[model samples]
Structure formats: C-alpha cells, structure tokens
Target chain A: MATFIGMPAFPEASARAVGDAQLRHNLRKATHTIRARRAAVVAEQPDWAGLRAAGAAIKDRTLRHLDVYLERLESAVTAAGGHVHWAEDAAEADRIVVDLVRATGETEVVKVKSMATQEIDLNAALAAAGIRAYETDLAELIVQLGDDLPSHILVPAIHRNRAEIREIFSGRMASWGRPAPEGLTDDPRALAEAARLHLRERFLRAKVGISGANFAVAETGTLVVLESEGNGRMCVTLPETLISVVGIEKIVPTWRDLEVFLQLLPRSSTGERMNPYTSMWTGATEGQEFHLVLVDNGRTSVLADRVGRQALRCIRCSACLNVCPVYERAGGHAYGSVYPGPIGAILTPQLRGLTGPLEESLPYASTLCGACYDVCPVAINIPEVLLDLRAKVVAGDHRAERLAMGAARRVLDHPKWLALAQRSVGRLRRWTPRHLPGPLSAWSDTREVPVPPRESFRDWWARRAGEEGGR
Target chain B: MSSRDRILARVRAALADVPRTETPEDVEVPRAYDRSRSGPDVVELLIDRLVDYRAVVREVTDVVAAVADALARRGAHRVAAPAGVPAAWLGGVQAVRDDPALSAADLDALDGVVTGCAVAVAETGTIVLDCAEDQGRRALTLIPDYHLCVVRRDRIVRTVPEALTRLDPSRPQTWISGPSATSDIELDRVEGVHGPRTLEVLITPAL
Candidate 1:
C-alpha cells in the first residue's frame, strides 16, 4: 500500500511485513524458486568458481581504471557514430534524457526496463515535463500503471501476485496505452497477453525508445542489455531514436572483457545460463540515431572508497536479492530505494549517504550472513563492506550511534569505570521495565532483551575463584 | 549557463577530483598470452562449446531438409526466422511459413525459434547472439523456449577472445551460455525461468 517503506526503520517496516501473510507467501515462493535454480545452473560449471573470480577481477580492474576505460568507451562510441553525454546526478541525467526526447519532438516513448532511470525517477520527472514514458516490460508496466515503485531488481513486481497484477491491468491499462479486455481473468497467461498486445501497439507507434545498459563494451562502443522479455528488443529497434542511460560502472575495457561478462551476467541475473533476449546497440543504425548518457550520480564518490568500491562491479543481477534472506523476509519496499536487497543495502547508503534514519539503518539491516557475497557474480565482499559501513555509522556520520559507541568504548577502556557500570546494572535490573521509555523503546518494541543478570559474569568469576582458594 | 554546461563542468570537476589510478593496467585479454595463434581453430572450438552446453547438434548437409525436419519434429505452431536468415536455410519448414515479423505472442506460440548466431565459444559452452550482420534483432530466439540456433563452423572459435574478434563492431550482440535455470534454498531446480530451455544447434559445415 505504501509507495515505499522509506519513512520507517527496519523494526517498524519488518513489523508491518510480518503481519502481512499474503506478502510473505508471495516473497517466499518467488525468492525460493529463483534461488534454487540459480544454485543448480551455477554449480553445473566446474569453472563457475573460476568464472566468478575472473568476473570479480575484471570488474575491479575496470573500476580501478574507470577513467581510462570510460574515455576509451566514449571515443570508440563517437567514432562508431554514436553521441555520448555525461551527467553528474539524477537530476542532470533526467534533464539530459528529457532534452534528447524533446529534440526528437516525441511526446511518448517505449522504455526498456532500466534501473538507472528508476534510480533517477525518470518516469515521474518525464511526466512532469509532459513526456509520457511507457514501460514495455510486463512487470514494469504493471508497476507503472498501478503507480507502484519497483520492489525487486530482476522481478520488480515480485511482491505482487497474478491476481493483483490482473486487477491492475483490468483497471489501469486503458489510460496508459491500450486498455485491458473486459472481464480480464486472474490467469498469468491472460495478463501477459493483455500486456503483449498493449505494448506491441506502442512499439509500432513510438518514435523514440529509452533504455539502460547492463554492460558497455569499450573496444567497440557497444551497449549490452539482457532481458527475458522481447519488449526491450522491440523498443530498441522499432524506434528511430534510441537514447540509453548507462551507469559509468557499466563500461568494460574490450570485447575480451565483454566475453567474460556475457558469461557472468546471465547466470547471475535471471539464473539463466543465457538470457532470453540480449539486446546490444552501438552508434546510429541505418535510420536511427544513438545517444549514450554515462551517469555518475553518486558512483564516482562510491568509487573513491577502497572498501566500498566493490559495489560498482555489480552487473545488476538480482541474484543477490533473490538469495538474500533479509530481502526475502522484509521485501524490497523496506529498503526505501529502487535497489532493495544486498546490493542496495551497501550501494544505497553510499550513493545517498547515511543521512536519514532510512539510509543509516540499511547497513545494519543484514546479519552479515554473507549469502549475498557468495552469490554475487563479482564476489563483492559484502560482509566486509557492511562491517566497514557499520563502523562509520557508529563512529562519526551517525552521531547518535557514535555517541553510544563512544560511551561504551570509554566504560570498557577503564576497569574501575566498567565495574561501576556493571554494579549500576545490577541495581537497575530489579526495576527494569518490560520495555524502555519512549524513543529508546524502538530496540525492545518487537524483540525482548533478557533481564540483566543479577551479578555480572566477572563478579561471579571472582567469587568462584575466592571460594575455591578458601577450600 | 545551460543545464548541459553545468553538468559538463561538474563532471569535469568530479573527474579531476578522482585519483588517476590507471597506472598501466593490463587488459587481461586472456588471449593476451599467445597473442598471434588464436585465429585458425576459433570456429571449431565455438562449435565444441555449444555442443558441450547440451545444445542438440545436427549437421545440415542439405539446408532445406534439415530446417524442415527440425521444425516438424517440434510441431511448431509458428516459426520466427531472422530477418537476415538466408533464403535457402528457411526455405523448408512447412507447418508454419517462415515469418520475420511475427507478433511476440505468435512467436511464443511457436515450438521453434531460429536465428543465425554471430559467434560461438568452445571453452565456456557459450554462443554470441549479436544483431550485427546475420541476426536481425535480439528477440528472434528469446520469446520461444525452444531456440534452433544456426552456427557456421567457421563462425566458431576456440577461445572467448577469438570469438570476440568475430563479433561485428557495429551491431547489438547477445551472448548466451546455456538454457536458463535457477536453484532455491532447499536446492530445487527449475527450468525456463527466463531464457530458452531447449537449445538446438544447426552446425552448417564450412563452405
């Protein structure tokens, strides 16, 4: 019901989710299906481990020399007859995209599913600019028509069931492009048919198409997009003007580097050894013009950090999200950003900074279980990043947590001070309420803390030692 | 200043601030090793890998009979041939006429999806599906779960790098390793999650 659970902290958001039986059932089923298939296909290759290592190494090398590769990519694209644009942030990316659409004088466009656009909230911004962006991917169209935010990266509407989708299509599809047939049933095949018919018309009519690339080949100035649906291909080729917004991290050094990724991406993204529709476009074609926008919203900042930079290597494969226990339980909406799983857990905080309660709480969302890291095609050391971010949150940027950790550090720094603190706990234990007062109660709101022991463990240890000595 | 100018300036500044760390890093081309002797067997190796991925291999001595028999076995409801598919190769398939511009639903209804591949790699059991020269658009092999991909043995490469060399510098390319699948927590396997579940390869002998 909420656009995003952006306002609430984890406990609050999780409390709401745990109470929703339907949402839990949907997430449990979807996540389990994808997670199991990914492991099986991944294990089929004895070289999968080697492939993971190579993928991680390639991403590291590229990001480490991101400037050089991006420069090479830009020139290669321009030479191939494509135009390249640079955008600093979401607003700039949105503006550049809007201008590109406007220059063509197109009022509407068919869009391939692009996380970069969603990150910048391009659809909302475009709507405000009087340009309608039509989402061609079925799940994306569902979310767009229902005016919903994407919950998962790969399957954006992973949170919604077929019945909910049917309702959305039956009620909302008309105003968008083509309305659903009357008396649309809850069957998935029916909903898909409705979406296919609706999008096919737009594909034929639209003059411009919008997309985001999964990888950009520097050697050939090629942009790679992988999708299960054929909608992306229709949008990319049928339109006369193709404007693609790709993150700067998408660049790979050469066709050789691209080869590794083409192998790594499919396995990681949709649990496919090879994706159904893999769309790649270079400069302008026979009658089409191509514009590539390299977006660095907060990526450059992310790239500057040695420990946190690994997130830039992500191929946008939602495998990490599907396998994440936290994401499966809390759902993507709880992450408060377009990216709502393990990758989002690390990337979102860094991109937006640990500013609000939402961002700061993200780093602590995981139990450091390392499931995401194991599944990451690039092997981003997620646990290490989480601990590093937690340290930052508890030290400086997150002042409230900083103050608490500072007090704990001081009490533990001196023995007498610690004993005094432990003694006070023994006295306070008797009067300890079932819950803490006011805002502090957030900790005990959903979970209960065991009552403080009558005597500290250290005190008990000393007493046992003394009794033994007397005996 | 226009928004573009402001954005350019900011991007420039951001570039300036980021430390230049590209201190002569190697491209790790993989073929960077032998460097020279990578060309001859590339196509044969690509075919080897495609077959390794469980792609059904059938040599088309006669393009007409081969294409017809492949489609007939599947009892295809429809057949989407690449816009660039050779006239002779698609000359056969009687159940459904060779149509390049079928609807997505119509494409899905078909039992067979056929397209010519750009490159195939031997080491990784993967094939390159690019929109450069032969493959029309990227969707011909995507919508339907059964993909009957054609690979000229000359288009095959021994290593990933050699295959990369075969890809046209101008068109969009799709690299496919194998059929799509996923594994859940209890480790249950599911097929056809996204891509084609059945991959059939038509290995046309080198002319």
Candidate 2:
C-alpha cells in the first residue's frame, strides 16, 4: 500500500464502521481511561497553559525560519558523521531507505515504530524489494502480524483488544520466523511476553534499523524518540546501519525549545512526567552508517497555507487523541488514514490534499469541542484549524462557495429578506420530515435535525435590545 | 521536492509578491536563568516529586554497592540489566543477566533490573533511558518492578527541552523523569499503574 493516499473518502470508510460494535467498544474504553488520566495530571500544574504557549511560540518561530535551521541541521548531522537525504514524499524516502539497507547487503531490518515510515508504507516497499522489515515495537508488531494498517498514532493497535492480539501473535508470529507458543492466552502480560521473545531474536540479529523521531534538534542535529518500551533501544544499537525518516516539521530551533515540548508531550499524552524511553542519536557510531531522510511530502503545501500551517508543529505525542471525545466514540479506523485522531483530522487533508473522498470528508470529522486544542502539547489551535479547513472545503473555489456565502450575506444584509427566510424555515420546520432526501439523509440517519425556530434570532435580539433601550 | 526546486520557487515568488527578506523581528525573552529555578533545582524538585510518587531516590558515591544494596533491599529474585553494564556495577549479584538476547523467560527469572544511562537531567529530576551500553533493553527496566537506574550528575540538564537535545535521532530512548504513576477516583493518586512501581535513582557525582 502506498500509504492510504488514493483511498475512498472518509464518509465511505466510516459507513463500514457504523455497523461494527466491537471497534466502538474498544475505542470507547481505551480512550476514556486515557482521557481521564490526561485531564487529572494536566490540572496538577498551573504552568501548563504557559508551557503550552511557549511550545507553540517556539515551534512557530522554528518553522518560520525552517529553511535556515534545516540547513544548519543538515550540516550538524553531517559533521557528526551522518549523511542527510531530502525526500519529496514516500517514494523518495522509500528509495533512500531501501538503498541504505541494500548497501549494507542486509535483507532484514528491524524497525523502531515510525509514523513517517508508515506514511511512506515502508514495510510493504521493503518486502517488494526482497527485504523483510520487522517491527520491534509491541503495538506495531501486532499490527504487522495482523497485516493491518495502524489506526492510532501512539498505540497503533488501539482498535484491537487482547483477544484480537492473541490471534495475530499466535497465528502469524511464526510465519515471520518467530512463532507464538501453542495455547497462547489472551492475557496482556502473556501476549507481551510472546512478542518480547519473538522480537528479541531479530534485535540480536538485525544489521539495519529504521525509525522516525519525535523531535529533531536543528542546532545539534539530534533525533529523539520518546517511548514506553525498550525495543527501540534494541533495534537502534544492534543494527549496523541506522536510518531515520523525519518530517521537516519535527525540528526544534534549539535545546531551549526542546524542553517545553518534552514536558508538554508526556503529561498530555500518557499522563506521565516523562516517557520510559527517550532515545537520541546524532549520527553514525562505532562503524555504523547513519542515514537521515528529511521528508517534505506535502509539508511545503501545508506550510504554504496561512491557517493550516500550525499543523506542521506537531510532536506526534498524541495527547490530543487521548483527550478527543469524538475520537473516543468513533475510533481511529473511522478516519481511514495513517495519522488518525485530531492530528489526523487536520493533517491528513493537508498532507494528501482533499482530492480523495476521505480527504475531503476528514476536515469535518471533529465536533470542534476545543479539547484537542486544550491538550495539544504544541498548542495547535485544532478547532480553529479545523474550521479553517472547513471553510476551505465548503467554501472551496472561493467563487463557488462564495456564491453560497454571498447569497447568505445578501439575505442577512436585508431585514425583509431575513424575515421572509424565517417564515419559509418556520413553515418547513412543521411540514418537512426530520430526515432530508438523498445523500444529505446521512446526517439525519445518525442524528435528528433540530427544527428551525418560530421566530428569527435577529428579531428576538432586536426585541430584547429595544426593551433594554427603553429601560 | 529537491532543495533547489523548493528554494527556487520561493525565490521566484519573492521576485513578485512576498518580501525577499523582511526586517528581522526579534521577540524579547527572559534574559536571565531564574536563579531560584535552575536545572539542578529542577532535579531537586523532581526528586521531591518522585518521592511524592512513592519512589525512593538515593544519592550514591559508589555505584557498585548502591546497585547491590538497592536490589538486596527489594529482594529481587531474577535481575535483568542492560548488556553494556559494567561488571563492577553488579556488585556480586549472582543472577544478573547481560545478554541482550535474553528471552522473556530469561528476563522474568531475574529478580530485578539495572541499567546505565546515556544522561541525566537534574532540572526534571529525570534519568534519560537511552538504550545505550549497559542499559538492559527498555523492556528489561519496564517489566521488572524495581528499576535501579545509575545516573551521572553531569548528564543532568535543567529542562525537558534541554534534556531532548542530548537524545539521539533514531534509536528509542525512554525518559524516566520519575517512577511511573497514575491517579483515579476523583484525583486519588496511584503509583506504578503500568510501569515500575519502585524507581530507585542512585545519582553519582561522576561515572
């Protein structure tokens, strides 16, 4: 799969989800627990708001001067004995990663869970080139064994529970060379153990490792991975060739900018002070070859937008996902793309563009609850960004959408016109059925349309203001 | 797109619409590091915070006995340490395992876990768990109840961002700012909800 770029629209994919009760149950339970924890811990610190502001500001400043900082980062990485490659998108990144692993003459590479690699569909690409890519991260391993795409950002397999996990591990782990023991149970600990035993073999044997960074330091040319598991350590060090794929947005201007994010990310995400594992590698070490692919893949297009540009600041901490009520109920798979949750809502549209069905519908996924913005470690105003994208989609081709807004503006510009509009709406409110006709019926299929008011709010407001004036 | 293509477009666009370069706008920031809140002070705060979370922090002069005593106190039956761990750090522990190749069964047999660090941050009162050297694999520290981490004072930094600067780009390095903890029941706090219950940090003045 070349990333789900050419997939059907989100509404089409979500229609499939409307019938699946299992996904809803898993998503609801997991998201609520994590959501409650994030709120409680976030409330502990009074400086959270300040920290968020600083994080947002720092990222804004860094992205503003990204050209200068990225060049500096490339130079710093090279001076540290690392090689840097610029990738336009998934294909370029895949080509570079495959070439690096091939140069080592190693057919097998162990991977640290990387969303960028997922964005490029790296494993499938590697398999096509006659190489095997093993996922060492526990959540990713389950996803790999199941031959399923990742539905969540932080926990890729959030859609699947322990029972589903056992089947994947027991049935498929061995075909990949590490089989689960017979009579595997659905206990998490047991499943984790099976994964551990299976992954340990590759960790000791792999000569190449692939990964993505949570943050990349421009001044130092350092790449950082904040994880709860130790598999990342096993894969990065054991491999002779370490290849890191990073988005241009992952950069922080300096160490000072890095601190604000580290605090904000952990607390908002796992509700911990810091992740259990934070890995940083500057370049090649002890005769290892280090290759960095700085992926642009629609990033420049995102950066070009005045409103949507804030998305490029994401650290991928997934704090927003843990907090989003919509994501909790709907689940990650409903979004039908790689980057799911709130980040996915805005980022997917910008990354791949709204050409596909899912892309156009993604910007509408949110309730604009503002919780995603509140918990965003980087302080991306998700609601504002979501609305901005909505305006782009609905009002798209300013000429076309402008026609609607213009008609709306004209009716609002005249009192008589407004009154006539109210009468028509009031009449329809009584006679019209709750469900609209045609594809528009999907809205009422899931929810009831509120009947229009007896009188326009403008008339009510004028009446109230007149009373106040008389007083 | 290649750098030339991207930058060339920017340059061409600048020829007409956007400024080639605007007057550099400098936003004012705090001039001085707050003396009351330094990296060392953050580390101190982190220690108090960790203690509040119920994990014990011990400042150690000799790491050998610190590791030995910590494990002895915890009554670890099977101990898993990072592969690059110095033999001296073991301090006569009979069952310590150094193989990165240890199966989960082998890891489970160990009474506890120990690992060396790539760096430590005093400001955050956190230890950087880079899977470097002897820091047994991340799971080694995570699966076991007692996490005995050896931190060198010099590795410590003042803030989370500063701490990130010291990390690598590729490998997974887990950051343990404090023992793992969570709270439920109207803000009733619980320790070791998922990860290590007892986090013993033996901070040494030097490696």
Candidate 3:
C-alpha cells in the first residue's frame, strides 16, 4: 500500500530509468509494436473519428450527471440481487474488501487484473489481514510471482522479457502452488503453459473472486470485463462470492453505450479487433453472490475541478502510454504510481493531491508533445490539465521562487534599477559559473547557463547615437 | 453523513458551473458512427476476422457432421455439451452431458466443449454466449482447453452495435473473439491461455 508513497521526484527516478539500457530497449520495442498495430487496426474503422467523438461526449454526459447515474446503478444492481457499498477513500475500500473476504470464511481469493484494486492496494491489505489473493492474468502472475510492482497499466510486467519470466516461473512457482516444468525454456508459449499449470489449481478451488469492471451499465446494472485470457472468466464465474471494487467514474449510463467503448478499448489497448473474452454479468448469477463496492478514493476530489476532471474520462486503455515519447525512454516505474504515462502525469497529482515532492513533480513529467491527446479515446486534454496543475503548483509554496519573481518585477518597474542590474551583470560576465551553486543547481542540472553579454543594449544604443552626432 | 450522501454532495458541488436548468440530455453525443453494414458479405467478413485471430473456421452444410468432424480432428475423446445442444452434434464423440453441472476439475479433465452461440459479430469476429441452455454456465466454455462452437449463418450480424441490439443485457454473457490469447509478453500475441486455447467455429445454414 505504501509502495509509491515516498518515491523520489520524477527527475531523479527518470534519470535512473534512462540509464538502464535494457528498460529503454524493452519499452521502445514494446511501445513501437503496439503503436503500429493500434494504428493499423484503428485505420480499419472508417468511423473512428465519429466513434472517438461520441466516446468523449458520452463520458462527458455521464460525468456531468454522475450522481444521478450512480443512484440508478445502485438501484439496478440491488434489484438484480447484488449488494452495493460506498467507500470514501482507499483505506475504507481496503477495509470493506478485507471484511467481505473474512465474512466469506475463505482465506484465499482469485483475482482478475483490475486497476481500481491496484490503486487501492487491495492485495497488500488482504495479506495484512492474513488472507491471500492470487493474480490470474498472465502478466499479473508474472509480477506477483516475481514480487515486483506493475510498471504498465495494461501489461503490468511489460518490463520483463520472456527469459526473465522463465526464471521467475522456475525459481518462484513452487511456494505459490505448482512448480514450473523441468527445464522450462524462454519461449512465451512455454512460460504461459507454466503459468496455466501453476494457477489452475487455485482457480478451481477459489471460493471468492475479486475484480474491477471495465464498464458498469446503469440501465441494466451489468458489469463488463474485457480481457484476452480466459482467466478473467475463470475468476468471475467459478467463484461463489465475487467482490468488484470500482472507481466512481467507471459508470456508463446505458447498456447500449457499450457499443462505443467495446469498439474503442480493445483496439486502443492491445491493438486487437476485439479481445479474446468479454464477460458481462448483471449482479449475481444462479448460485453466486455479488458485491459492488463504489470507491471514491480521491475521485470525487478530482471531479471537483472542472479543468482537471476531464481525466476521469480515461478508460485505462494505455494508448497514451504507448504513444508518449517521454514514457518510452523513462518507462512506467519512474512515474511512481499504479497509473503511469501521460495520463498518469495529470492523474496521479490530482488523485494524491500535489502534497509531496513526487506528486508535485509528476505534472512536469511530460514533454507535452500532445501525442496523448490524439490517441485518447475519450479525448482527455492531458496537456491542458498538466499546464493547469503546473500553475497550481507554482501558485502554492516555493517561497524563494515567488520572492525572486517579486524582486524581478520591482526591478523592471523602475527603469533606472533595471539598467543598473544589466550593467552589473555585464561587468560580472567572466565570474558567471556554467552551473549555478546551492539549491539552484537542481534547476541548472538539466539545463545550460547562458553567459551574460559583455555590454548592455541601452549603453550600446547611447554610444551609437553619440558617435553618429559627432560624425 | 453517509459516504454515499457525502460523495453525492461533492459531485453536485463540483458541477456548480453547470446551469441547474441543464439536464444530462443537454450534453450532445454525436451518433454518426456506422451502426449497420452495406452490401459486403457478412459471413466472409466474419470468417476473415476470425482467421485473423487464429481461430479455426469451417463452413459446413451439415452442423452435426461438422461438429463430429471437428471433435474427431482434435482427437478429442470426451467432450462436454450443454443440455440445449442437439444430441446429433455430439453423436460421434463420447459426450459428457452437463446435467449434473460438472465440477471445475471434471471440466479440466475433458478434452473440449461444444456449444451454440447467441450471436456472432462480423466486424469483430466475436461470438457471444449468453449462458443460455445451449451455452450452459460460463465455466463450461472456460476450464476446457479446446472449444468447438456452432455459429449459425442466420445469427451473424454485421457490426458490434447490431450485435448489442440482439443481446439481452440481463443474461450473463461471454463474448469470445477467438481462442484465449495474450499479448503480455513483450506485447507479442500468443494464442491459447486459460480459456480454450483452440477455438474451432462451424458455420452452418439456419436450423
């Protein structure tokens, strides 16, 4: 739960990340592959622009009346024999989930890959409560087995190659459950097979399943999950009790609205025409029990800002991450949050509040090339929000900066003082250091200092006038 | 105050800029996207899309013979079929009826599963199962390593929007685009995962 709490600021983290040649290579190769595939598949849809527009508008409409839609969703889910709970923050959400699992009398639960649950740090909470949660997705399994933090939103273990995956499976699969096959190779097929064998037993015996929804239809009270592997199906269907921790923003007002997102998400996320499996269930099915926990967890605070709130429209497609130039070199781990990339740059600071060095530094993480805006399905103006957050940060503390700007304003207000300062800087040109001293070095570390000119423009203009008069 | 009440209040306060007279409908959503198809052959498109996902597709005049042939081709000995599935579809194989609702372990031991789809989308090559009698429970299609689905030509639609209209949201639904696959490894797709690794589709004329 505290994994990202005290991480260093973006500059330090990204500096370290860029130096790791393997990470940069992995990110470049993966992002480029997915980027080309997404472009090709997206091109196949002639109505893609229309779809993108409608997708953005629909999300806007939903957010504008989120209260109304959430009430309707709660009623619909209740009518369908599902229980609904509201959590104000991550701690409350974790407590609710842990209590639910404890009530089920099961010490272990199977899980589908869900960003909401990760944001809440549900796995760590479960472990603290003496309960175990197993991650069923191929990438999640790799991360869980390796005891690693997820780097990418879609591909959690995207940083790890096939060989590293084989090592994790062979070295660590035993204590969890079934061990990897003897002499397992680095082939993806073999690694996937090893995971299949490793987690199959847990899936069959799991009595409780935990998940997050891709979309929640308020009209029919149905929850939809789109995934490539059948592990999502196994987790949601095979378990007797299912708990879904969903962000308040995941709601779409009607079932028909799915047509827009269903077409948009798969192509944008994994570059597939449609993911292999999409499960939609309205509340409890036959012998199963369903619980829907609506988590605020700073989402309401995010919604309070009209300029920053557009970020809530994100469907977690990771398209922005794949297209971001800064993300390709620096990678996901550098962002220091479960959410990463261009979207993360704006989202993390807002959600966590620009309190510490990490949160404050996140807004400046992007180069603002606007690749994220173009690929965004919901059309979240990420750069606009980043600029907005930057203004908010500067307006806040930073006493020295404010004081320096005030002094500069004072000098500029008086023409005589401005001329005197320019003359002094010109005279001191030789003594100017390439890098600034003290705390100011942080700013100059990545930038070059421009040496002062030998003469002021005012002095040069006056001397030229005098020479012309003499002639 | 209750968490729900507080959260709702926060949402209302956040939208103070939005005029009270403006309703949710005030927001405009452009719907010019294609919801239906033109003259292209839908079946051909479905087949092409399915093949693109590495699914094994066969066009047959006789569904029963095709199903039997598909199972035989995989050398599948024990196949699980839902109650609503026609007995003839499993005539050539050792059919395991889901009357008792096979346990997860039992389903895992089976060679494969055969079922009928609610609808198939031509554009996305997706076949949806609503857990109708023929499709049984969701796990029936999962757990097993191989799946042979019977998608009737008449049940195919041209686009995702059209398919959505035909589906009942109340029913628990599973939309299968192809065999279970993953792109998690360096973003390279490798088919066959937790779901049926091999998905074989038999397209036949209306029953």
Best by lDDT: 3
Alpha carbon lDDT of each predicted model: 0.74, 0.72, 0.92
Which candidate has the top score in DockQ? Answer: 3
Model 2, global lDDT: 0.72
Q: Please compute DockQ, using alpha carbons, for every candidate against the native two-chain complex.
A: 0.23, 0.22, 0.82
> lDDT per residue, candidate 3, A1-471, as tens digits?
237767899999999999999888899999999999899999999999999999999999999999999999999999999999999999999999999999999999999999999999999999999999999999999989898889999998989988889889999999888989999999898888888888888999999999999999998999999998889998999999999999999999898899999999999999988999999999888679999999999988899898999999999999999999999999998899999999999999999899899888999998889999999988999999999999898799766666778899999999999899999999999898888887667668888888889888998999999999999
Candidate 3 regions off by >4 Å?
Answer: A403-432, A451-471
> Over the stretch A1-471, how does candidate 1's per-residue lDDT look in tens digits?
225534676556766776788888989898888887688767865566767777887777777667667778888989988899988788989999999999999999889899998888888778888999898777788788888878888888877887788888888888876889888887665666677668766775679999998889887898888776566767776678999999988987766676667667777776655664566777786457999998888887777677898889998888888888888889988888888888988999899888878887888888788989889888898889989888877775655455666799999999999988998988789787888766556566656866888899889999999999999
Those runs of model 1 whose alpha carbons end farther than 4 Å from true positions after fitting are A1-6, A395-400, A467-471, B1-61, B70-115, B121-149, B153-162, B175-207
| TM-score, cand. 2 | 0.81
Q: Write the per-residue lDDT of candidate 1 for residues B49-168, one digit (tens) a residue.
A: 555555666767776678778877877646766656776876666333334356555666777667787777655566777664456565556667788778777776665547666667
Interface-residue RMSD per candidate?
5.7, 6.6, 0.8
Q: Can you tell me the CAPRI class of model 1?
A: acceptable
Weakest 10 consecutive residues of candidate 2 chain A by summed lDDT: A395-404
Q: What fraction of native interface contacts is shared by candidate 2?
A: 0.18
- For candidate 2, write residues A1-471 as lDDT tens digits: 324655566666666765679887877777777777678777865567777777777777666666767787898899889999988777988998888888889999999888898888888889999999988777788788887877778778888887888888888988998789889997665666677678666775677888888888888787777766566756655567889998888988775566676777877777766665565667775456888888888887787777888898888878788777777766677787778888999999998887766777888888888988877877789899888888887766435456657789999899899888997898677876788776556567767888898877877888999999999
* Candidate 3 C-alpha lDDT tens digits along B1-207: 999998899889888888888888899989979998684798999999999999999899987788888888899999999999989777788989999889989999999999999999999999999989888988998988999999999999999999999999999999999999888898878898888999999899986
What candidate 2 gets wrong by more than 4 Å, as runs, is: A1-6, A397-406, A424-429, A437-447, A452-471, B1-19, B22-66, B69-125, B129-148, B151-200, B203-207
TM-scores for all predictions: 0.83, 0.81, 0.95
Q: Report the lDDT of model 2 for residue A457.
A: 81
